[model samples]
Target: MRLPLISAFGLALFSLQQVAGITPPPGAESLTACSDVSVRKEIRSLSSDEWNTYKSAVEGAKGDRWIDWFGYLHERVSTKIHGNSEFFLYHRKFISDYEKILRGYEPNVVLPYWNNMIDYQNPAGSPILGEKYFGGNGVTDKCVSSGIANSWNFTYLGNECLQRNFGEADTIVTWYSPEFITSILQSSTTYADLRAGIENSLHGIVHLSIGGDMNTMHSPADPIFWLHHSNIDRLYAQWQAVEPDTRTYMYDGKDYAGNDVTLDDKLTYTSTPAYEVMRLGYGNMCYTYDTIQTANGDENALLSKRQRKCKPRPSKATQTIQKLPAKVLADFYPSFNKKKFSALENEMSDITPKQPMAADCSKPFTPPKPSEKMRGKMPYPGTLSKEYIKMMNLNSEEVRSAEKRAFAMIDELNAANYLSPYLFDLE
Candidate 1:
């Protein structure tokens, strides 16, 4: 007797339940499949009502201990999960769980991601970092003095205010470009390869550039952390979607301690298996990004609606920098050398500067200075500098030597753990 055939969707649902150990809640089977559920939009794409709904949920979470829960989790699991194979999947689960918590406060609330690459040239100038959103960099005492989170105080850190020091000095530095991120997405073929490319380059740079609490293991204390990770998760989702058949269940690479990672590897502090969180739109994962949705062919109708209602108008600087020719950009910004220019050209093959380039190009450009109060709070002593291009152009020998030094530092941290003296008094 031949067995009955099952559709691909049926096969996927069965595998998701059996292999990934995902059991939909009672009556959830009558609900939409995870793939057909809600969509997560970019931060700039939230409508006024959508933005207000999200902000309300975040503010509500602060009073309800949701914020503290995330901070505590990060403090406990930071070292073990970072710089390892678990980095992507662990955070994917973490953020999804966080979104679920927010939804508890407001059913309509979906956490939006910040595509930091779009603001790479001028991070501080982005509207997402404005007083209306997460707010500008830290002011006196490194306390974030603006935005919806301005009044937030964390009980875990002795009720201190949330803090952020945007850049090393009064000026914010450049970040990895969309073009560069596109390269990373295209070049990497394996889970480990993509993980290293993202964690080492784009991910690490954002943390370093932001500084303050963001630079610490308890970085989740800052609201921006969630948005940042949401984008990271979106990238991981995009990568998986590119080759869904094989990539959905793919789990390889090693943990920080040099052990091979497996699908059954449990996330820190949770009963959830890593394999369950690896695939988006399955199990606990029920959302997709606009970019991914568009790639899968809905003509981005959902994104278009949000874009019409919520997208922030691009700033003149953002427009000018994005449009500038490679040669012209190299000339205007002294940071680019021959090798770096070539790399930029390769990554941005279709870039074309707007006609009759901005009149400002005729004169030497000067970045705006911070307010007088912020000048004293600048973290670095000297004038702000751009160092990433030079760093990226380092020789192979230099790169390997630096990796050795980084590994040694990690070893020291691992050996000490909580044994190390407290850098700051939490109490």
Candidate 2:
């Protein structure tokens, strides 16, 4: 028996629905999975209430099993996740898992991402690291004394306070620019290209720039780790949204063993397959960034009343076109000589007369000299300098060695079932 032929339009629609893993109900035009919608905002954008709630959730999670849970998982998975094809997907899953734990304590809590690009020129000066937010760099003994974890103590790693030592004093590390990230989003075709671009550049810089628990295997001990990863995840999600047809279920790259990575590959410590985590709004992945939702034109994603008012509205009046004086125009279009344009200039001169130029404006336009205060005494630690690049290279090798050790330790733990509490059979 012949099957009914599906129209090309119907087939395309069905395919898109399959890729997005969401189907609208009958009579519904566009449907967003309420549970799947995760609105991650910029750290600096969070309101006072939201920031306090987030801080409380992080503080509350300290003594919870979840703290050790993430710390141990990071220790075990750090080497395998980084510098591999699984870099983006693995971290996506990791951050989602972290957010779930945070929500267990504060149901309304959603981890706010740190768009490091906003602070790319002056990372140290960003308010996200101020005493009001995550706090600045560590002081004595490399211990953090302010922000969310100021008074919080950790028991998993020898009962020490969380730490964050900026790479250098009075020096702000340069970070990846939004334009650079946009290039990666546009140019990257396969999962590997995007993964490499992100893991090496923005990802590494943030960790190194933070330079404390963030630079270590158990970086999750630092709350900044989640925020940083959330931003990374946001970028990955944004990249996927740019071309959902191919990117949603796309998975290509190499695993730690140098074997080709497939969607079926299991994320470490979770029963969930990598493919499940690759797609947003599907399986264990039930969160979307505010940016992504806005891009998709989801009106519900606009949270606050202020945000609703900020929607693009049609202008009441057409923009009035101001015509330049004929004399001024003569300079631009020399073919229309000033002599020939004199009549037209006389006609409109009253309406478009030139104002007297500022005295300094006519001066050779000398730029203000760079002040000593504007110049750093030392190069940014995150700069791609020979020494810094070499350090990154060494760090990559160190990561591999750490991964090897972690795998061996994991094997021993598995034999004794020591990872039972930390391991989740995430679907």
Candidate 3:
């Protein structure tokens, strides 16, 4: 499905986050100043006092505006700033600004919790976190009674921090996978299908009745999810450096489900303009990989070149050890295909592994019917037919038209400078 366009005001908000050094459209100069690294450093370093200060900023009548600002920033990064130059030169700057801001207050003040099911052997009790917040004792027996597990399903908390504290600054600890690494691996192999297969084989998480697999339920409530995603974003940046030609990951112009989906198709919302989703989403946007990191830690060189010198000495172990070069445990898993590594190696020897190319548009694009179970809740609102549209008190044509307008507005916004904070001078 094509994406919806944004409103003029939304476009303006998007422009403020851009910062490309290349010559953008008229008035794009404003976009060039938005993604300040200093801003990121400050957010990363935020201390209790700084948080309190920021809280005060939100506590005032206009405090909610800050939330809106973050929302806008998320949308800008997700949708606009298409292509690699924009991805590296602009989007990275915005994330850097956020990181700098976080680091500015307390560089060491890491997000304390990660997924909810980590070795709870010695579960650390917290006044704010734990079964108390969800109304259970910290013990496994009491955890379910509190409604902590599966409560914040699909929120960031599920992805990163495992504990929950209702509305307070509470945290939860849980076990989860790293999505960024999975994405990288999935790019080359059928990782998504494997993930589904694995989750299905396990019959999903032990107690959670939310999303069956860990991936579908990831949200921002868990603080660690952000850091994990940040690292994923860094990997995307790193990948861009190594595979300069592999900017877009779509093959056959269709999504994994074999439905026609362009990179921009993922950006649009059927009903609303989806500015908020854009700010936080980061799904569809033009971006090239950033300069690769060399073995010497230099940015902008070929990553493969660095990999050559850093190749490991072969071991005699029967099981192949896929080289997971990244530091994080999550990053390491997807690098080697455990199931098909032997076949993959043979293929790699004969052919240059190419990412899936876009769809062959010469053929007709057919519309498929939605499954029975997918009727009430479709990923995109527009996926349903006229019958579903009537149930929602809307016409399919009107929805389609609205979405068309939204997509146009988004493009205009990008062209105008809504993503200024992302761009930076390459020099």
As for candidate 1, its clashing pairs are none
**Which 10-residue span in candidate 3 carries the lowest summed lDDT?**
349-358
User: What is candidate 3's lDDT per residue for 25-51, written digit by digit as tens?
Assistant: 232223222221111111212333434
Candidate 3 segments whose C-alpha is farther than 4 A from its true place: 1-174, 177-244, 248-258, 270-427
- TM-scores for all candidates: the values are 0.68, 0.67, 0.30
**What are the root-mean-square deviations of the candidates from the true structure over C-alphas?**
13.7, 18.3, 20.1
> lDDT (CA) for every model shown?
0.60, 0.57, 0.27
Error of 1 at 382 (Å): 15
Q: Summing lDDT over every window of 10 consecutive residues in candidate 2, give the lowest-scoring window.
A: 349-358
Runs with alpha carbons beyond 4 Å of true place in candidate 1: 1-32, 303-427
Q: Arrange candidates by TM-score, highest first: which order?
A: 1, 2, 3
Clashes of each: 0, 0, 88
